[model samples]
Target chain A: MMATKKRTVEVELSTSGIDSQGRPTRVPLVVDEQGRPVPMEPTLTLEPDMKDEHMLINIGPQHPATHGVLRLVLELDGETVVRCVPHIGYLHCGFEKIGEYRQYNQIIPWTDREDYLNSIGNNVAFALGAERLFGIEITERCKVLRVIAMELSRIISHLVWAGTTSIDIGAFTPFLWMFQERENVYNLLEGWVGARLTTTATRVGGMAADIPAGWTDGLSNFLRTFPRTLDEVDRILTRNAIWVGRTVGLGVMTAEEATNHGLSGAMIRASGVDYDVRKDFPYLDYETYDFDVPVGTAGDVYDRYLVRLEEMRQSVRILEQALARLPDGPVNIDDPRVILPPKSKAMSGIESMIHHFKLVMEGPRPPVGECYVAVESPKGEKGYYMVSDGTSKPVRWRIRPPSFVNLSAIPRMVEGHLLADVIAINASIDIVMGEIDR
Target chain B: MTNFSAAPVGSRAPRDVVPASPRDVPRLGGPQNPSADALREQFGDVVPRVDVCWGETTVLIDATRVLDVVRWLHDDEGQSYDYLVDITAVEYRDMERPIEMVWHLRSLPYRRFLRLKAEMQKDQPLVVSSIWPVYKGADWLERECWDMFGIRFEGHPDLRRILMWEDYKEGFPLRKDFPLRGRFSRSEQLSQALAANPEARYSMEELSIVDAFQDLPADVRERLAGGEQPGE
Candidate 1:
């Protein structure tokens, strides 16, 4: 076949280069047969100069990426965040104010709602603090059981954090995998505590009930199988190029800054400060368990991810040790003031019936004193500061919520990063607005 | 190679120092923390009372010298309480009793926990020096304390309400006199919420950052400057 003659038109380049927004202002156009350049489909209009002008944007009091009712007002210079102002309290129920009215045991349910992901952990923590105020030592079995509950709570919290964080960074597979493992853990919690999310499984001196018969088999199965899911997630995300690109250099807080800002849990440990409440200040025999506290050097979002992942492994190790050392004894203390008599005894003996009635009607009272007991919660150093005026109800009850304090440092972390990076940094902090607003 | 798994250089906690749970801790008057003695030696009369409860030491300092004591504790090489665990205030049920401000400080290296408290009389202005200068973490803590207990931290950069909206009119919710149900009736609370402008969710400082409210009329600006109160 004969080749047709090739026809080519020489087109001139655009006049101006780029606009303020870095978009090309004009493009080359083809000419008509008369060598007259055809008017380009009306030249692209240049965007107004936005160089020196700043923009204000609000994220959410209801947006999903915020994790809960956390609103952030950000001022942007171009695409970079100049300043960030976080507005919380949409979920505020005045947990502390209500605690002053209810008895110690009644306050356990309130703790569940604050950091709902770690409800069982908060129960253990509140019970520990109240027991301290009442000046009572829990049974040895109770201590070991509380340790198991705390470790399990930590696993649940870290899984949720990882799952939601993965979703935030545009990865769906890890979220599903992580949450499947979380559901398994939740099932274990349900078997033990009878509730999934709000497990008020503790009393002032003991748990609500001892572990049901053969419950250890379920826990042992979880301990054996949960890490395989974690390993799968690590394989999917740990070395992912996109994940590393989005998180490696974002929201860096040096050790000094992290410590000064009161950032805790995986946040500070990611910054290279080896200050774990479990190791630095021991409680509930956390020191007795043999497990490593994961520390990271970068202090960035990726480091936080790595730290939390390692923490889950460490939690698994602690759970294994706790399972091996599980003892046989009453979970509640022997003291009659706090523990109720047997139902048969109360029905038969008149004195036992009166004691039961008085104990039920009037709550146990602590002496005139105050105590602040802090625990290594999944979020960080969760403390409960309580004061007694020799009354059935506490004079004052305060929750030193770690998420609240950790979230407070968001403005600093998100200041210089891009607008999209604010979400990554916020997710890395692992804030539960319930705790912050409470 | 961003040191993802690498440990920190010169980490705060040493491997040799192993912490154990406190067993058989006395109900009252246990052994005192070393920092307590050091604080007494450093500022003899400023620290008037030291009490031990549940193996935790509480050192009461004069209200005026809190900043001084905290700065010393932070800067002094010997007593490096670099981490501020928490800052909260407690009001006793007895109306006559003074309110107490509690500061929980931890020295990561020394493995010490000390509680510093300052008491303010009910009649007093309830002003205490802010520790934000020493620890930046004190920013929201002091703000929350003021928001809840109505105790002012004199020099916090942004001393506004944290857990509550800025223009909340009901008295401090955590005060002993504040009712459990709240100061206002349910109907009143509902009306207030309905009347409140959703646009005012952004505080003046935030709005002023971009001058977004500059286009509003003078009366609105005056009202906003007057503190964004509805039905004024």
Candidate 2:
């Protein structure tokens, strides 16, 4: 009725909601009966400092140094860190929850996805956790094969860091050279485990399948040339003044501070802690191997960079030894309680078929006890704490992801440095988001 | 005296236990003698009793004695589980005492380790002296236990959900009682069903694809209508 003086006004506030399937559904500002905030894709809001005591810089959940979905709320003063609050779980895949429902063996696929960069290491860690808790010994052939795979994984992980870090720090040439080697390792893994980045081949008590023939000899050739390739790259960067300037003394942390921040693997070792799980908590024939744990002089980004580079050479050394000591034995444990009877046993025998069915549907139980097993992962010490209530599924299967812990040092490492240094620091730490947020 | 081989995951049956590589030297505690009795005697105030079973030693200590115990193990001046290889928790919700905190520790100098079990009532389950202070790696390990099983490490600098999203509070998913099937967002299941059956009819389409086009926004309607002759 009143067309006199009218003006159209629109207030837009977009929000998200879940559809019937939990898929994120968005709404344009829907209000409830009570007029409260409805849940949406998890978001963070900085509480405006009521006191105005300090300035805050939000560093991630998207920033490059975070390596993944990690968000760090850093309180800083003139390039120096006053406080750092690390918030995680952006990439939380509910892996442990997934493991709870899955049969012990069914979880191998998920483990590969957690530490996607080092599937071999993940497989080995999980396999060892199962074996230690169940007292099932892996066969010699399987152990050596696993060793070959894991050492290769360690090398691949370092190569990725080298490439990614080089790109992060303004050097593009090393990225290509390093990725060339990573691609070689990936192709070899695909042949061995049927997947490139995520190999779900390592099984409890043994591997999921036997090596696809000539793997040992094939990997040996790769390992032989790997050193020369690394050496060629090293000649350019290891002692390069520019490389040292960006890394050395940047993100400096002492052994005490590193340990305090829960640094491990190269992060702790680079700080002069001298800890390597392969040497500390031997797993899967590691006791018989020969290699050195390279230690860093400073706990700084440069030291971490050095530690990982040296560690790659050491992993190659271990690979050489594994090749020479390859042994022949059953790959999977013979026990029906753990490893399933071969298909040959199942097709004809009713009992074997039933056993297979039960194993698939119900799964085997671990003894009523607890075991914590830590193995050297490419990132650091990837440990699994498995506890059984004597049930088919584990009462608890927890993974101590090295990337998650190592990345915690980011705020400390980059507190006073330029934002650009964050990428350098992230590369130095070698944080793999899948593993970190797992 | 429990010697997990002081063997770690592999058991060589004596004859096969070859000398460890430098890489393997620190395997399970760097070759130091981490006997339960010796640990008990060393931290008489911390370790009340130690039991060696299955070649692995489990140490029993009063909840209050943990700090003193770890002080002895980590910085006891002689033994340093300096490298925190790993830290984890155990939930014995069914035990007579219903204990929940068990810390596995290793001393690199001696190349040995022991599992410390601190029994506490579930309602007020608490323990002191987490290995986090000594080993940087234990920070997340302790946090994981806290997140999954509701175990707490008193002195951890940052203790919160490490895996589950910050807003999640449905019950610890790792607990024995948490159902595997349920607790998923309804939308999650719906989407999964939809993904599996991509051809399933949508509500608008069920109204008739021709009629559904009328419900589209003017812009989207224009784009789709452009795909065909209206009369056809």
Candidate 3:
């Protein structure tokens, strides 16, 4: 018997609306040469049995779907993924190695490049860790300002995640909408720090600059209009059939597994674990800010999406509270060791000039101690572990990159899922390769 | 199966658990984490040095019993340090100082954070028990620690180079002795980069996956055979 067979399928055409002649505007029926209706059937070809064989496929170090220099070698039996081995470090510049050579304040710029999406947040986190190492408590005004910076950066990161994930799942309109809101946040950041992407806005003891005069007005404007865009994207994607069908029930990790895998931020929270670092290990006075951490029961791709969307709204609430409780005081601590003198004072007074010169040249030294300060970054728990040797430079400055840890579970998440679902699952992880390979 | 709805929320600190903000925390020692005391009681000899710095407790334990202490910390109901935050090695500036391996663990249920350290002297082989048995997240963290610091974590499955390529020969980049510039000179590094074969990107684990090597073109297969042998 032949391996292939032919079959005929019937075509049914619907009638179009009536024409000017009042007749149904229907297309002419498909007919054969013998004056009979043609059965338009496609041929089906059968091949030899090959269930035992598995195919190996490679994705990126260049592909966009893998998201920035992430190479995945996947083992597949037909369409189902049997195994996945992720190769990274294509963008690794050894930021940790470089951190050892730079001064504490000088290292803030390096933090900006590691997680480019959450650059300000990383700067804030490094400042917090370095401040702890130095035993310096920042002023109340600086605290509130850092909180605003963090939440704004969080919104920027989640917006990029939402936009990129939507595009990955074949929804284009929401990507544009999400990116528009992200641009608004970036504009606000640019107004504050004068840089859009790499806003190294934090110093060791305080901000690089206080939110410029009337800057809270821009933030107020953002807080006012951001939710409208959030709601628009939510309305489009939350119940859209295609979005739900593609995202839901993929990359399911239970609470125990998520916690054991060291997942954090939205990744662990989506697994129904309400362990927000801001709440559990409260820093920047996050406990005083009244906001609910949205927890999800399913712990799948859909839950992660919902958790992230809700987090942006919660960030808005926190930003509003931070703005309301914005204290009026000095931004930097009243210490000459970590903070520099005013530019005019440095040029005018000898004592101020000596202080500024010493600080700028030698760099403020921290006592011999180590502090691991973790903040709940948009992706996960971004931490800066610092070790001081009573010297201007750090003995070791380790960035506990959350994306690296979250991406580690890709092999576990993608195995046993279909090849198409792998893209959705990887997108759900929301990895920044710069952070992962740093 | 875990109850999906009634999953364990945050920590078991209290019904109204509120973590202290950084501003309120003392500059130096205030209160030691209770787990530090508990670890001493559980493993007296292994838990040698316990210190509190910047309000966070650091417990220095013997490198040999790291896995045991970590497993007990994870399994024990009272001191449930369920989350492994990070694994890193710190080589101090002083050449004579022993390299310290740090493990940052967090107890989500109890809202407690603890640091565990194990020092490996330069004379001894940098070997320590892996905590992968206690936490699956330790897999990549251990591999990365090995990659950067050259600390070999015993019993770790697939503890290979993570941030660097498999055949990277520049020595551990994070080690104090390693120069700021890489081991190879600039021209030599550029020449090596230019001479690298593109086909060697795939590891033996990837190439051996179900007929991949056999499927390669004969000339490519000959090239690979002439190069560094797979599984070397």
Candidate 4:
């Protein structure tokens, strides 16, 4: 049997306006011979002093190398970038506006979506900020678990950064190897929190749950094997001729310039600024933990790589200490007003059930005050500034997203450099659009 | 094991009571907190309040002299707040001046953090001098404040929307009066766009399913459109 043919429609073109001399006076309803609409040419006006060699190009909002929806408008003079303007907000989710309507404890899951890579760190930052306003100190066990989760998330984040940055610099082998380690870390985290990425593993006053069985063994096993893989990847990319040549002196920013531009984390440390919020501000009992803050002398892409590599090692050190000192007690605080009652108690006792109902129905009311808590996230200093109005919901929940601030310094870093170097510089900064546009 | 009975109910645990480790303690104090004291001493009339919370100092200065005070804080010898950590704003709907701009600054050498606050009227032309000249980091931060809160930053090199698109004509999203779902105009525009595209029949539905259906063979596509299984 023969198949039926599809119908086609044809539209006529209107070429009505013409001069009496059979010559077109003005172009009216211009169309190609095939009846396709033809667009008019755009007019261009240039000054006499303007050079013809200068050209403008847009880099993203859809380009692969932009990391996310980040767009950059580049003015190029030959192969060098004359000026670069970053246009962001393609991923804006109105996190702050949405957060204002959410209760204190309910905001944890939302915080995870902000910086999806370091969701654990973002959760801890938000919880700590809210806890400060509530004037509630978490238990030692909770603090230790938070440190472990945060350091693991840091390791995972830095691994992704190293892997992606190496890929950006034309090394694919390291990317594969680094992701292997990241997968192991994710497996370990999945065992603990049931979710790998965007893990809302923390609560306002404590962790969502105690560490699962054999989770530590998995962490230790991964930690033992991670360093060997890290060193292998390091040997592959750290001193490779192409990697070194591509990243050694590219995107150099001085310590002064870094600080003036609000750069933090490895971005500032690579510029020889000895600042780490874990050491300087010391939330979650980080003051007692023993680890060295890695400092870099040059603020180039290579220095940032070295700084981040050393930072992952430092995170391992912190993780080991936290695991060893992990206390044996309740993860949540004893306060019934803040934490939910145990299920056994809630099911059996009236007071416990009532407390659970009240805590779940109306979240803990913090005093009317404001506090800003920053954590040394892998990208930079991720902070949460919250203002309370003696209610369950916050009056203002402002996220001090480090990627948003770090991405701002791109134009300064890319100016006067080859266009190819922009990718390396952007990768070295390691910005996540989720956080930047939150 | 540490004693839990002696501790007051809901009080902080004695976590820091452990003997200090032999690690070198970095000097965290600088010139007796110079930012608050020196600014109060110098700009006494302009500086209204100095609050110390959780070991971080916040100085509330007059709205007009915010740039001058930040510049002074940046250049002063004792209080060299060379780093601009964050810039944000809070809105109070019931207050006389509803919008308050907050600046978080830090001195790297001293490891001290200082917050500077200035209030502005809620109406249009909410102008405050830009601190871009003092710290280049304020460029995007000021633009973000302008974009989200509709506060204008005077003298900003490029004071445009940082988070929202240029074509977004709806009112600021972060304002107190703005609805959480979205402004009505945005939904109207969305419906208008949907109405304008007749060929986009499956655009509002599950887009992944539409994409998969588009990839199928023509007969299969027709079968799916007719609500029939691929293999009966």
Candidate 5:
């Protein structure tokens, strides 16, 4: 049986009145070096043999656009894709299998590596999962801190995104601007977390420690300048003839297609959906903060790009709001089961020291229930599913890594687009293979 | 790697405190049970029994009926479970049943999700969920199910080793019964061979048993202890 054909979600302009001869006088679909759709010459025409029989091209496992280790088998007829099959598990280290063996705290560092670019987000997702498992509550101060850290993470992740995506799409100015902001973010985060990429900084109930002094001022300065730099990128790319020509209507997805595919984050927002986990399902005090969910009319590579660019601005707005309300109380949950006693107390009291040693040697166990806790990361809804058997180690732990699901939609987005546009569409989606393959 | 070891693979199975079947577990007629008449009423003759837990209703169906139920869950009824959320497995080894295949379905329409399970024996298990048809997302999840657990998705377009390199005959490593490691038994076989022949395959010193005890060829006979290559 033949499968139903879906609509094109790639961004393109509405048709203009044709002049005289009726040869698609305005802009039409572009074709590339291999005759696939190109931004300049978008068309879906098949070769003679291709017209009769389809061709299947496996796009990744090594292709640059895949982000990391993902493989896509694209069955095409000339440039129009007939079917796209994704082969995953190339990076499945059996993380779920491994989680069953280690203590609850041992799993925090591992989450950081899943989405290396958004380690704070990954850490919080796990942190929230354990918090839910034990029914631990966070103080108002920690809630504000979470908002600040998560917002900073979102900005940093998107900054890397803007730079790396521009790097991919043959643009260099925006690349420099985005990276300068990223370097500032890196300095601020490192000052607070000690390590950068795999910072196991966020413990279960609260942060690892209090924020270093003056870090808030540094973050505010970064947030204040970020919008101007973003404006610079916006002025350069949003209206530039070539930039618009290349991205404005390329690799579009619509609301229906995106919803059906379970697309989320800026990718879905780019296609005009109004779903933001932070807003729709507010956790970690997001509802208290004021921010907007950026939406786009077209779900094209360009639309996704604009959505993310706008999202970074909104994230900055949130950071500024959170910074104003930054609290000064204890950050970590004070539960004896989840946290170690104070060193002074441990030194004076035998019970306190024994409890401290036990907490360090063997982590606290969660109850025998399964819970899947999700948080909105810069990329999308990053969630962790934990299964406990009344033990310190989890019975099973599975990551609903957004990259894994998001990468599945690549072939559909790039199939008819020009090969060069493939890079742009991939960058707009913002996938990290470590998370994808995990 | 393991901080704590569990019962051996061959040891007694883990037991579940079997609760009384939810009034919904419809009984069929024939010892070779035919379709449950009551079940056919709520759902069609083919519609499987739907069970509810935590407000989420899981529709248990035969693997052959996967396409129909999945299609109904997504299109025919607008559940728009158009999104294939996740696919994972469960091992029921210590129980009377040893294996269960789980498919987690999510519907963007209601923002609700459901879990489906196909209980099967360890020997031969079969299920037909043509992923390319339902949520194109299931294509990879289905491949992974086959790759790690060796579960077969009957209509899967492409099924092959996803993680382990080819030529690996070891059983699905995730199966509770599969050995955590397989090296120990391999050494026992080598030891028995050495007992039979001190020079098992051949001594490093000998070209051949004194059959044709002629001076051994340089290639076959041992040279120096550690001096190294002939090129030297």
Candidate 6:
């Protein structure tokens, strides 16, 4: 087939406003009577004039301000954010899927990694859920030990949040001061669990081991010195004019908004919601402890910072009370089905040896049921929903990660605020990527 | 005596009730609260079963009217569950209706907690309207349920995957049938792509920058782009 000649059409270009150099002629800047430069109107356009077009900008998958691999696509008009779409799962490791195949006690290490900064709290939350499922009431000593460990972890997690938030907002000195205290807390943890960061410190029924000799002495010393250091950092950042200016009126969430969004811990308390799991649910004998839950009126970054600082103080109070009431008993439960027997007994008797072997190999078989338990973790309510199937492993192990839920409110918090305020708002949330993407 | 009936699976014998400690703040609401009774009366047929397990009340409702029940619980003046604590799904592959969706709702004012669950067919895992309109926190949670268990929230505004990537096409990883080891391996996928495009510029082995240009001259990048072997 012969090819027909290509049809061509002559298209006229709009050159009326063109200069001799073939560039669009510059429109003179419009000015008010006072001589301030005003924006010029468009001379040529195909589409109708919209006042402001939104430009989409991506922040973090690697950004320092995000505190993790959280990627947020921000739609901006000028410098104010119009909308924010968060893209997560860059750090997803299928923790829940992996828990399905692992035995009950074997999943403690997984919880440790969920919130690396607050591993002990995560461990305690998971253990409490499992114990509730098995209907095993722990001993008084175990309860006191768990309370101490959880409060210590809460202090450490909050210190990290304080340091990171201060650093994000351009105050570097508080970070160093707070990290010094964090290092001390980590040393205290290392003494208890033999690990620093990911301390799988607690078991299903109790602790991995009882607190060693002199552990409380060091904790007491920390309790004394930590408050002074916190007060110093508080003086440095809480009243600094720049800190107040950047955070005071930014990202204010009301009580109703916070409750509807399911925020927990300081996120909700800062919004004036007086709900604390330690106080309300009263597990682990928290009902006996004498400490106040701090609530704030204005739910802004500055308010969150204040609430977290007050919570650390309250944690110190709980630590002091728990230390005073430290009981003398077996840390682990007395049930053979839950805790492994002593090596001496196992070696002396065949039945005990078989029990030990089965306990170590197959793990504890919880009853077929489900239970949901939540604790006041450093970030928020770190909850675990475990469904047992009369087997060694859980049929479904669901982690209600507080960071995942709290981070969902970032878009709502950052809308209509300046782009720079995103850092302050995100820092206020203080999310851990491991938990959010787990 | 092998007494299996002595202690049931999920039951605990009543212990001595500890008196309220001196430091115990009186609960905001009374223990004789009638929220459970109110729920039972309001949604009579919708909630077929109400179980008081381990001192926590859980209402088992039909999947068709889950939205109605939750809305009633949320909007009802006496039993307002203002806070939506958690939402998740559990898979029981052997059961007739294999998927169970669990929701934990808490009322901040009353200091009360309630768990609501609805069962869905394993093959058709569809739930009624999304609770995002009522609770904004359900946005990511509903997406997570859909990602992990393939449970569809019918009226969700954005129903895409949250924890998994957009291009992920494997079976839902949280389902019982999904293998412990994932269905597709990243290394295998890379190798297959390299095998399919052998004549293309880069192979799987050379995808890394350090491996692709180790100890090569500055001009080697240009030479390799011209289809010339760098080492030669």
Tell me what fraction of the real C-alpha contacts between chains A and B each candidate also makes: 0.58, 0.21, 0.54, 0.33, 0.14, 0.35
Kindly list the per-residue Cα lDDT of model 5 for residues B4-68, writing each as its tens digit. Answer: 11111111122243112112212221121121233345357464565543223455667667676
Question: What interface RMSD does each of the candidate structures achieve?
Answer: 5.1, 15.2, 6.6, 16.0, 21.0, 18.2
Q: How do these models rank on lDDT, best leading? A: 3, 1, 6, 4, 2, 5
Candidate 1: misplaced stretches above 4 Å? A1-48, B1-15, B200-232
- lDDT tens digits, residues B17-39, model 1? 67898788777897999999999
Q: List residue ranges in candidate 6 displaced over 4 A.
A: A1-51, B1-33, B93-97, B190-232
TM-score of each: 0.89, 0.76, 0.90, 0.82, 0.73, 0.82
Question: Which tens-of-lDDT digit does each residue in A298-349 have in candidate 1?
Answer: 8999999998888888899999999999999889987778777778999999
Q: Per candidate, chain B TM-score?
A: 0.82, 0.60, 0.81, 0.67, 0.56, 0.66
Which pairs clash (backbone N, Cα, C closer than 3 Å) in model 6?
Answer: none
Candidate 3's C-alpha runs over 4 A off are A1-43, A46-49, B1-14, B24-27, B201-232
Tens digits of per-residue lDDT, candidate 4, A392-428, equal 9988999998988898999989999999999999999
Tens-digit lDDT string for candidate 6 (A166-250): 9999999999999999999999999998999989988887889888998999999999999888778877877677888889888
Runs in model 4 deviating more than 4 A are A1-51, B1-34, B93-97, B185-187, B192-232
Task: Report the number of backbone clashes for model 4.
Answer: 0
What is the Cα-based lDDT of residue A159 in candidate 1? 92
Local accuracy of candidate 5 as per-residue lDDT tens digits, A1-438: 211222333343433344456544444344444656534424332212222644546667787666677676665566666565566556756666666677888888888887888888788779877776765677778878877778888888888887888777778888888888888888888999888777787787787766899988888788778788888888777756666677777778888787766677878777776666675545786767767677777778777777787778778888888888887778877777788788999899998888888888888877655555667888887777665667787766778767666766776787676555666777788988778766
Query: Considering every candidate listed, which one attains the maximal DockQ?
Result: 1
RMSD of 1: 8.1
Q: Which whole-number lDDT from 0 to 100 does residue B85 have in model 1?
A: 87
Tell me the DockQ of each model, to 2 decimals.
Answer: 0.36, 0.12, 0.33, 0.16, 0.07, 0.17
RMSD of 2: 15.3
Worst 10 residues of 5 chain B by lDDT: B1-10
Q: Order the candidate numbers by DockQ, best to worst.
A: 1, 3, 6, 4, 2, 5
Models ranked on TM-score: 3, 1, 6, 4, 2, 5
Question: Which candidate number maximizes TM-score?
Answer: 3
